[model samples]
Target: MSALRRLSLSGLATATAIAGVGVSTAESAPPPEPARISDVQQAARAIQGMTLEEKVGQLFVLFAYGPDAHKPDTRNTTLYGVPTPAEVVAKYKPGGWIYFNGRGNVESPTQLATYSNQLQTAAINTGLHVPMMIATDQEQGVVVRIGPPATQFGGNMAHGATRNTADARTAAAITGRELKAMGIRQDYAPVADVNVNALNPVIGVRSFSSDPQLVSDMTVAQVQGYQRDAGIMATAKHFPGHGDTRDDSHTALPTINHTLEQWNTIDAPPFKAAIKAGIDSIMTAHIVVPSLDPSGDPATLSKPILTGVLRQQLGFKGLIITDGLEMAAVRQQYGDAEVAVRAIEAGVDQLLLPPAPDVQFNAVLDAVRSGRISEQRINESLLRILLMKLKNGVLFTPFVDPAKVATTVGTPASLATAQTIVDKSVTLVKNNANVVPLNADPRKILVTGWGVSTTQALAASLTKRGATTTVAQTGAAPSDAAIADAVAKAQLNDVTVVITQKAWDTTVTDKLAKQQKLVKDLLATGKTVIVVAVRDPYDIAYFDAAPTYLATYGYAAVSMESLAKVIYGETKPTGKLPVDIPVAGQPDTALYPFGHGLTW
Candidate 1:
């Protein structure tokens, strides 16, 4: 029997107990009840009741925005080759429509709800009478697709730091409330991938934690928050784990080297837990785990990983989705329309944002007509999809206006909540002689760095504080001339603060060498030089002469302004380093060890 069947048997007993429906003592226990028919199944049943073209139409999910919004094509037509939703409904009725950027200059909850209502109205006009699934990447924190910075929710690392499952759940509840208010039914969130690699470029703060158990625990809370509290379908993403890989699947295909045994122990635990917790959906990663599939294909296209492990071993009965097929990792490698056919056959129920909609749709349609793909396989996937919609209460419903979009999306209350969380997450990494809380007057201050001057938004915030700040723009490596100029200005000032903005890959290497020279020159003049590392704390390792070094983990405007307040003693440096920064590649020999922080 499939693992799903066994799991369903357990769920049946639990449901029966909850409902207080007892077994009769007169006869053998009744045959096991089937698992609840999900909305995906309901939608599939409705489609099965339709004609062949309508069934094929139900399989295609069109982009909300036109193809031109993504990339230009040779034929000057959008790559999807499918007409707009209004056009498509006029001709061939599609099953569902997925939205990207909608009709708003700025995406607030109010605007999203307005656009979502319009989109649903268009879909309903197709005469299918099905309310389409409106989806968005409301992952929260740095990757938020909706809400403003002040009102946005915190990322996984912040939740990990709090170590409060309730808070995590509350955050997901907030995300769901906002999305549901905007008429969005599906949320691609609660990143289930454990962040084992600190160097992972893309999925850094997006992950809950480096520990698998912690990730599992928090993921359960988030899933519950979104599903039970907010009543939206929650999706656990990049299944089979995308945490350990170094290469970003957005740019190129990444490979994980875990053995089957290792994957079972390390990577598969969270997904297993999420399944047990009753998550509604799972999104496959574009990563190749050689141990699971020796052919080195992305898990989205791998039968062993998707069907064998996710379906059979992990026993996930929810909808299975593939990552965007437009990503370079899939596009560069699998250039044929047949790959989409293979992905569906391999076990993925939904092809997310495929690059070529017409080609992909035609390929799946052709496979169905021919014997390459079975009708049962297509029915199985469609049933799962419909069942999910039914579970979310979307299958047989008409379009309903979102009731709470404006009040919850970017309200002052939400912004205040975000600020409270951000305040707690700031970690103070180093303080030697308590040299902070600069005693010098604000009238004579000189600030030099990359973002200090160029980013006008940040500079304006500083100017409001009644400080005369001169910002010097320099290349990755500031020339000796720039350093000399900064030193001269510092010698004339009572306090000199160097605000260095570090890029993601640590680009200011050669420029940092020159910055070090400038620091030594200013220090020789007996001037107090405060070096504030605005990106990563590790940049402090390069400077030896600066007496006061501060790290503000991110370069966001709020973070920069907060760091300034801490340096001036307006607020105490209460944050401790979230990640370890080793000195000379030795944890023990670290300059400023992890968990190091001071308040003045």
Candidate 2:
């Protein structure tokens, strides 16, 4: 054991004894040295010295239950029979931990930092003494895990509209700085997928742009900001691209029929740029790309795609992590254990969030012992993992000072930067009614829309701007009563602002049809109507009848305030359309072409 770890353990035992608890002989044993190899050769030597179980353990990044690392939660048990996150870490010895807000893994910045420190302490107590790769999908906008006191910046599409690489870089740097402050070392962000399909269900506002060059530039900038500027390992995700799929991998296995030429031209450029910029990791998509792999397997389990295309053809040298293993797309063909083995066989360096960590870990361990998976293959992944840990400061600084988390995470400067991006990225798509830049005299405005909280936020912003605002709550699909109430409210207001939210690029739903009906109904009132798409820009294509329209690409606090400013002429719209808005029900025709924005 290193002297520092031994001293820490000694102090712990002494404290326990002082509390009248006896110290066992097990507590007296020296712990292992910290995993802090500075070079690849040193990492290789450390890997060589590791036991087979320890080496296999380095391949998985599992999720455990409970908010506090040390607090036992019998209600939510892992497959390994562990009750606490620290126990899970000690028992499984996995490479890392992936946190999810839905899983009750995150609450606030200081609490999360404390949780991380506890886990790191548990990891050090184990035989490997390796620091973990603590990660979370803080993708900002819609896919955020940590919320509130953490500055809520707009997502990729919001940055895409700004058409500024510097904005992307600044956003990523701020995200990285905040995450790192909370002891999170890996961020699955700056999605590099080129969104070409208008009907893509999942990658709509999460993607930077439809144009490959724009996506490439933004991806490179984010990669540099996260990795170089903030010292966070940025992961360029959904590799081999998930932007063209009609189905979401979380529910179904989507198939992309991009020809090799088309894939190289459209989807490959952003990933190429990310690789050139030295992105630390790439995440594999669950979608099947026939052009890259003739076999019907998704990219997560296809050797030809993960090994041949990504590793050899594209020459990517970073860690290749599989998307969440619990997703239905990858689980459709094989059981959990078999899926884990196949992922290892397919050149995946890290298996993310296996539903059954123990079963998956043993499967890979048995594969090595049975000669199905060569130990050299395991060594190759371990070396890469260790190198990443070394480069990203996970090995050197595994724990964060919880006291500093609050000051570092959501500073005034970071919030200002986020607001600036939103202010610059709010696109005024149409102003034929000239209803925007509301008159100097206070006007009674009605705010109603799809998301209740988002619409309420907009109303609050408008209210702050000295407008007489009345808000009517609306659901994802407005009910008849909601529509009636909104219309009644609109009758009292001089101008009605409707906020529409649709994150998916899929076919128009019955809910969307009802939303369209609501907008048309509001327009029929003959009062000045302003339609603002707070989530997806394509929402305008569904109801183009509204004479005054705008697109904010997100509904974050900064975004809503910026939208209010644009509406009141306090901020001029400078954003261009990052992705083309296809005509309703017609993906081929453009209602608003890319880079289309009107400034008054």
Candidate 3:
């Protein structure tokens, strides 16, 4: 019953642009209203006084390499010419920044806050006085850029397992609040990807559900939660869906084969919901949808998709961000320069994580100077960027107190909520012999997985509940010695629990094959095998012969605790599966459909 395709970005072009700015194009659509009338006026006033170099800088959102990266000597091999610290600050000051794990060498909260302050201070020092939109990929479940002390909330698929929008909203709010406290102004989150393909390596658990309506509802709720609670910009991302692809855009270009009509029906709902909910931004996916443009171009480089479909047809009233331009999907096809020119031409307001910031900035600069791309086009993007800053309280307030950073980041309340969500989301799909809630006398368990820490964590959590637990290797690509040791332990234990971890590699199927063989080998030991898919839900398909199957949907502490509690009946298995797995031994058929789950 969600709003299927009801988003109308009517009059957004005129409202979002700086109000009353005269343009040479007489018939140009007026800017859309995304900020207060006075804020728009202020933005217009500010734009009227900017230089071409300053305006060009507003289009880029580069990565903060690290604190020491500011020095001139830290330069590495340049793919596209890398920017020196001095050059970046003086010649091509970027308008925004994005942080991923280890990007800024963020070892602590104070360090991150101080570094963020330094970045903002540098931007201000460039004499433009414009605040940068510091964003981080804080999608919570599997993709957390900020490390621990930040609450490990249940991911999107976990939220889907509960089938509750209210809880999803709460989790998003907590994420937003924590992000704001850490001095990050924007979060690229609430992955609106619909997990239609269980084989999707990157988007499996990051997605909310296979059901379009469920994804739509959760997407809108999370966006609203972020804006309402944290007052930070929440992005609805990987537009047109990364859910159905077998490839990850991070490494390659994926093509979605759906027609326009088909696209409208399935991959389009969550984005529409985000637009209708007044979401601030929509991130472009790098996937190719031939239905939109037969040129085999990814959506990031496709004008038909960005301007024609998103800007015109869908009426999205805010900023349109390109997925990380450094990603091999686009990076492989074009030079760093082409990435910027084509993306801006395609109507992207912001370019994220450019491979080489200086090169991209220079490329854009030359293009505009040569009139290959007009100054007006740059102004359009700049207006949107300025409006976002104004609306998000960044234009006037751009500083963070380093001392308060750690104190405000994570709270016991948020962790408790995370634990509640994890407890509620540990899905049990199959218990052939009710092997769960470990009713066996003097239960002895052997946990094996890819990461020793995670395997040991699960074992430790179970051990605290009075069970004799031991851990083996992750079994991703188990060595013969490891296999022998695991098999030896398996024979002694009543149940051999295989904590399967999905790999994000071009060689994923081969790794899965190795893991499948290991699981089959454990089953050969004539002992009970309980397969816990700590990451991908499709894991059950690879080893369906096991006596038990569980999907934790994450590997966070909360997730491990949930697994422990579910095993001992401390937390009842109440979650339902959000995605379907291929029927065992039937690749052409779906055995456990979306929303299929079992509890004992």
Q: What TM-score, over all chains together, does every model reach?
A: 0.78, 0.94, 0.90
Model 3 lDDT tens row, 420-486? 8779998888898887887636788898867676788788888887779888884577776777788
Encode model 2's per-residue lDDT on 169-234: one tens digit a residue: 989999999998888999998788888877777888899999999999999999988988899999
Give the Cα lDDT of each candidate. Answer: 0.65, 0.84, 0.77
Using lDDT as the measure, which candidate wins?
2
Query: How many pairs of residues collide in each model?
Result: 19, 0, 15
By lDDT, the candidates rank as: 2, 3, 1
Report the lDDT tens digits of candidate 1 across residue range 240-324. 8998876889998889888888787777888888899999989999988998899878898989989988899788898888888
Ranking by TM-score: 2, 3, 1
| Cα RMSD, model 2 | 3.7
Decide which is better by lDDT, 2 or 3. 2
